[model samples]
Target: MKLHAGSNILLNLLVAVAVSLVVNFSYLLLLLVDQKNDPAPPPPPEEVLRKAERLQCGALHVSPDGHGYLLYSGGDSIYVPMQRIRRLGLRDGDSLVAEVSVTHVPLAHPVMGKVLRRNGAEFDYGSLFKRPAESVVLTLQLIYYVLISFILLSILTPVRFRYSRRRFIVRCVWCLVAAAGLYFVALVTEWRTGRLVFNFMTPRMLDYVLLLKCSFAVVVSMLYGWVYVLIMQQQAVAMENEQLKNEYLTTRYNMLVGQINPHFFFNSLNSLSMLVREKHHDKALTYIDQLSYTFRYIIQNGQNTLIPLGEELDFIQAYGYLFKIRYADKLFFDVDVPEEFRTWLLPALSLQPLVGNAVKHNAITTVRPLHIAIRVRDGYLEVANPKAPKLETEPSTGIGLENLRSRVHLITGREIVVVDTDTEFIVRVPLQNPAL
Candidate 1:
């Protein structure tokens, strides 16, 4: 089943908790069996008993045989008779405080103590670590479980996501082999260090139990690893989809920009024909020179996704020259970008389209001249033109502005800002440092 990110986190936590419970349950079973086979040490040494007896009503545990009990105080356990069980009724598995006394007694009835109060389970964790070597071994076992779990989650999980079905199966098999190898190493270490000795089970039975525990841990690790792998796979698929969408948008924008070139060439040729018919030979020569320069710039850089702002400006100036010759004193173009920001990056041919759009949609005559200005402000390149909407003109395809906006968004993840008013129209393209 597919799970959300939150559910994945919850599942991971649950797995950890389950692993802990399993380990603790196995240890508890081992502890019970060990206690059953070995009798409690005969009433601690005399000096130890004396020290224990001086302490006030401390913890007590009922004997497994139910014939007697052990009273624990000051880090010592003193055997006590059942008769001394006083104000609080005695029972197996009940923790309580009792007054204890040291004395020589018969084997049939050794303890001599009085029960004072029942205090439920003593919760004395220190008692579990009474033997220094056993405590160290237990600590090492805990560390081993934690380390194995972490490696399975952090390392194997990613590997599963990165491989195919056949490879993943092979990886899983290898992981199991590694886990078994590590378990064997741990067993050898414990055995060599004399930490595997158990009073309850025979050595064969002990080996079988250890094997069972290790097998359970390995299985749990694999299960949790699969869940993590599933999560990683889902995230990877999502990222891939996003990248594909961005590529589609970029291609669409480029196609739209490509359409502008044909229409621009047709308009420039019409202007050139007019100049030739009017017998303006010198003006026609200048127009041809400017047109060639502009076309060369476009041809050289049109395929590039981005170019330096200064280069784009140079292309725009050459393009503006063609329009100036066509309209004479009726059209004007001004550029005021800062020198420091000239090296900033921008989409190629981004500004020329805006200039062409202004001339196409607005009437340019001596009675009412058209003015276009390009400048930089507030980390954006501003292209502002005075509005003079044509009453009778072909409807706009809107491809120019849309293409510019899409390219800007795809490249920088930022939108181009447009502001239109009755008197003026402005487009703001965000500037980006080339070094970044």
Candidate 2:
């Protein structure tokens, strides 16, 4: 329920107004009743009793002619209208007390002003009725309710830079707490425009009108909070799902690009032919075995997310053999990794791209042999080789190294660092400690 700008303001404002209207529904009904039944001077008091607006008490008596009277107020009866008797459901024996006014009419009796009580219990006029339901008074009430609701929603719904589980829990707790507090405040003050201190302690605890207004306030506030939390949680989950879908897609793409594509397949065969031409049968047999193992390793491990460093290095040994046999003394692998780092895991085939890039981009010769070092340094698997740029070389697309970098990050949430200087090209890939 985070509020955004423009259209969101109008939507939230409407939500606030709706909550206010519902919460004050009973009070609004009372307003409408008052507007329809505005009490008029009751048939000119039959006998002027006292000044207007004085309290009068007597027994209620309604006649068949649609007229009613409160008998025995200071030995004189007061005129009560039939509509008031019907609204209050008054009976002949019922004791009633109300404000009375004197009107200049002969023998009509003093007219009732406002009903204050029936029997022993007090009546809440504020709850039962309010005048001017559709007048400027009602408009003021509407404005008051709208303001309260708008502010409440503006505070309740907040914009957050990022979603957080802990913060969400805290906010929900606060919402219920605020609702509980607002319940008491609403009881003490009027929810509508009658009065802020309207009818306090007038209605008994189980009064239906009182219960309706209070319950609506509490329940609607609680419901608003519940709906807000539900929407926010759902949005967060949807965003997370979308992000994972993209990551899954990227990982699949990297795996496809990682497959060995016969880059050195024909080169190995040419080296093997030279060995057989020189009549070195044993060496050629060993070369075929190593070449077979390299291809098998690539195909088998391509689907895997991660493998032990030792397992990857074993495959590299088979892979490096073909290159070593081709270069002979011009290229050499200086392996210096310890056995302790062998169990650490990294992405499968992570090192192959680095090795391929070293050979593809640099020139190796008898004058300055390509001494590629594979070692563990500061928790990283470091592969370093002295730069020997060929005088005339094709431009490198750098796709292989970029592919490895993306794969490693996708699997381990880590980055691969590459430093290419005048003398050496160093690539350091992070290693994850295997879970015990």
Candidate 3:
């Protein structure tokens, strides 16, 4: 929410000026037209006495007439028409409620003057300045100043000055200082010229004080609003950046482990070489097809955060075809995937590595064929293989299992698990939905 100091200063200035102008313009219309000097005039003692008699008569009488009624409270009496009181939405006496009525005096009185001639409803400044128009103008100007001040301060504070309490306070002080400057300029100009600037003072002084005050008020309000909005925008951008950073690190780890397990690669290559050496050219081409399929699936889908569990299982089935062809009657696989789990997601190549591990590590022959199974249940993909370790002397890199686990963890924030029982080695990988 922190705002640039220069911008904050400019904004406060603009807001102060705008508020001042609005106040000046409203007073110009409502109060300034009648402001003037006038000679002395006489009083109306008789009408005042009649109104007082009406108040007292209504106060003592049970009912003045069907058309009017009286109310008395705290040694004061008021007389009002029954219709008017009803129109005011009053019932009985409700002390907490306020009642208001407006009374207007005629701009011209036939009895007071030499019957002043008029053109298009000309305003009367009134005798001896009895109307006190300057007071009305000053009240309006004060109200305008207050409204502008509140708006400017609200906008400039808090969100804009988020960095430090002191900075926010400083920004507010500047706005008030600008207001005080306007007040002083007006007060001093009045003292010198015998009139406030906006109240028809000379054009030069009027332009200077009015323009500066109004412009400052408007600019300050806009700056505060702009700073607050921009601060929120920056915060959202920062959060997005943090999220992307975490995703990048996760993707990098997945990529490093996603490289095909070297042992599996070499073993498949060795199997293909043996097929060709035995002059089984067609079957070697079939093994080549299986090898190509495995690599292509990984390369194409590895960048994907989620692939359908069905797709990974399909790749496993294709790899199983190659293993069965190589071991002939000595390799078998069973699939137990539920229809519901088909569309559920796992990390790309998540299942293939576990099946590859079973094929590479287990012993299989015509008399003792290896058995592998793939199943989906309870939001997990379960791959179980017969525990028939064949290459006791072979060193294990453990890269394939670790790669699967890393991918799962990166995408789902859940663990990939391996379990071995007396007869079966099982891997369970948690499933998820794609980002879409």
- Give all candidates' CA lDDT scores: 0.70, 0.72, 0.61
lDDT of model number 3: 0.61
Q: Which predicted model would earn the best TM-score?
A: 1
- Candidate 1 differs from the real structure by a C-alpha RMSD in angstroms, to one decimal, of 12.6
Q: What is the per-residue lDDT of model 1 for residues 1-436, given as tens digits with 9 covering 90 to 100? A: 4456566555555665567457757665676687679965433234343677443444456665555455454565566555544323456545555454645655543344544334533323233323345446556666666555544444455432464567557667877877666555553223322434332333443366557666777778777676666666776788788889878876776686688789789999999999999999999999999999988888888878778999999888889988888888999888898899999988888898799889999988899999899999998999999999787886899988887887787777899999999999999999888777
Q: Which stretches of candidate 2 lie over 4 Å from their true place?
A: 1-207, 210-256, 259-284
> Least accurate stretch of 10 residues (summed lDDT) in model 1?
122-131
Clashes within 3 Å, all models in order: 2, 6, 22
Best by lDDT: 2
Candidate 2 at residue 97, lDDT? Answer: 66
lDDT of 2 by residue, 41-109 (tens): 443232222544377667877788878878874667888888877776677778776787888889767
TM-score of 2: 0.48
On the 0 to 100 scale, the lDDT of residue 210 in model 2 is 42
Candidate 3's displacement at residue 248, Å, is 2.8
Q: Which scores higher on lDDT, 2 or 3?
A: 2
